[model samples]
Target: MIKTRFTEMLGIKHPIMLAGMNWITTPKLVASVCNAGGLGIFASAAYSPEETRKHIREIRKLTNKPFGINQILIGPGAKENIDVAIEEKVPIINYSLGKPWFIDQVHAYGGKVMGTIAIARHAVRAAQLGCDMLAVTGHEAAAHGDVATSMVLIPLVASQVKIPLIAAGGFYDGRGLAAALVLGADAISMGTRFILTQESLVHDNFKQLCLMATEQDTLYSDVFDGMPGRALKSPGAEAMMKKGFSLLQSVKSALEVKRMLNLPLWKFIGLSWSMLKSKEGKGLLIQARSATGAISHLKAINEGDEKEGFLFAGQSVGGIHDIPTCKEVVERIVDEAEKRLKAVGKNVSA
Candidate 1:
């Protein structure tokens, strides 16, 4: 078996991780990955605080192994959801977008915090902020990757920080895992690959679409969710890119979001105001776009609506050919990584 700082840190058998895709990483999927000896991260961005707590409890019932929750710090209910996780003494908490204000709280309770960043400078800051590890995303990732690809970003961040790094984007197989290790990453996180797994809750229609996608089948733009991110090329994605900002659509989606979270009208408005004053100054436009994108994502995952819904997918979709169970994927990746590493070692002479 392959081992690294990530595996040792998380006490998992393999140096692989589920990428915590929103609406995709449910309790079942997360527990499956944990049971398969890999780190499974439940995405809590789509759920309310109560739902988050319920899901965490469900995961514990499914697997006694280590698992984590991924939260987007900039989203509404982020603090509440994180608070719920900490109250439950979760083993690990992973976050993306905005700074983690509860790192100390998590560490105080013997929990680790993982910060995800797509830029090298952010990696240093995250480590300085006491993040236990970093998930370094590359431009090839499905969502929110900056300009740097894994080839350039992983080693750059590795050279700048002492903590373990989980390389994400453009990684889908054992060859990718071995390559990440050589690139100075302790592990590799796979989003698109996991979405295609047998245990994934993604609709089979979208899975088939992903399987048929090529390396160039993804589109990256700020239109999808008011942030530069990649998504599978689909009619919905194309329409969003062309439609630009729609005040009416955004407002409707915003209301839908408020309903989904079951936030009091005053509380929802307060959250929006807080976001406006946040360090990033996201304001309501971004929030509205995000709400619309979230709905579209659900349509693709739950209803298989290809015309009006789209799924975030990485370039790695090109390399995935089968929908194996979580266990099969983990074992295959580790075994392949072992063979590739040994073969590469033999090719080198001192």
Candidate 2:
């Protein structure tokens, strides 16, 4: 059996984690992964405080095994969602997009906080902030990614931090997990591969696109969320690339997010101000100015309107082809990793 700091720390059987992709990592998917011995993380960025509670309760009902919640630190309802997780005393709390402000609070309740970073410097900072663990994302990641690939970033950050690290980007199978361990990561986190699973609620059209996609089928641009990100090749994405930024469209999207959150106007403004002050927001000030990307993402993932919606995808889509259940996926990955590891050991002994 595969053993690593991630598995030991989380008390799970395998060192695999499901990426918390908004609109994709539903309660059903999370429970399935937990039941299958892998960690499943629920994406709380798109959920209201009440919705987050409901999802957490649903997962509890489905499985007594451990699970986690992922929250975007810069989202409008980030604090609210975090409160829900803390109140629920979740086993794990995963966060990205901004520095965690309530790390002390989370730790006070015996909850672990994992910070997701794309670059080496951020990994060091996260470790310094007492992050229990880190998920280092490479450039081949679907949505927001850094310039370095997993091959380069994982070891680079691992060398600097003693905390357990999880590698992301362009990882789809057991071979990838084995390779990540070799590069100093304790586990691997995947988003694209999980999206194609039978339990994922993503429309079939989106799944088909990922199945048929090639490495060259994805393009990177700053058009989606006002920051650099990767997405599958589609007419809508292409059009956005060509059209450049539109002030009117951006404003419209921001309004749409406000309505979807159902937040009071003053509350919305306060959230916007908090985001603006964050290091991530300050670095990408223009991108943080509007919420158009949120609208596009909802449309694409939910409506499957490829012509007008934005679908954030990772390059790992190129490696996935089957629609297996979550249990099948986890078991297959662990089995393959064992096979590959044993083969390597035999070769070295011989």
Separately for all candidates shown, the number of backbone clashes (residues 3 or more apart, or on different chains) is 0, 2
lDDT at position 149, candidate 1:
94
- Cα RMSD for predicted model 1: 0.9
**Which numbered prediction scores highest in lDDT against the true structure?**
1
Per-residue lDDT tens digits for candidate 1, residues 1-350, read: 88799999888999999988888999999999999999999999889999999999999999999999999988688999999999999999999888899999998988999999998999999999999999999999998899999999999999999999999999988899999999999999999999999899999989999999999899999887888999999888888888887878887998999999988999989989988887764788889988888888889899989888889999998899999999999999999999999999999998
Report the Cα lDDT for candidate 1: 0.92
Off by over 4 Å in 1: none
Candidate 2 accuracy as lDDT: 0.87
lDDT of each: 0.92, 0.87
TM-score for candidate 2, residues paired by index = 0.96
Q: Please give the TM-score that candidate 1 achieves against the real structure.
A: 0.98
Model 1 residue 194 lDDT score: 94
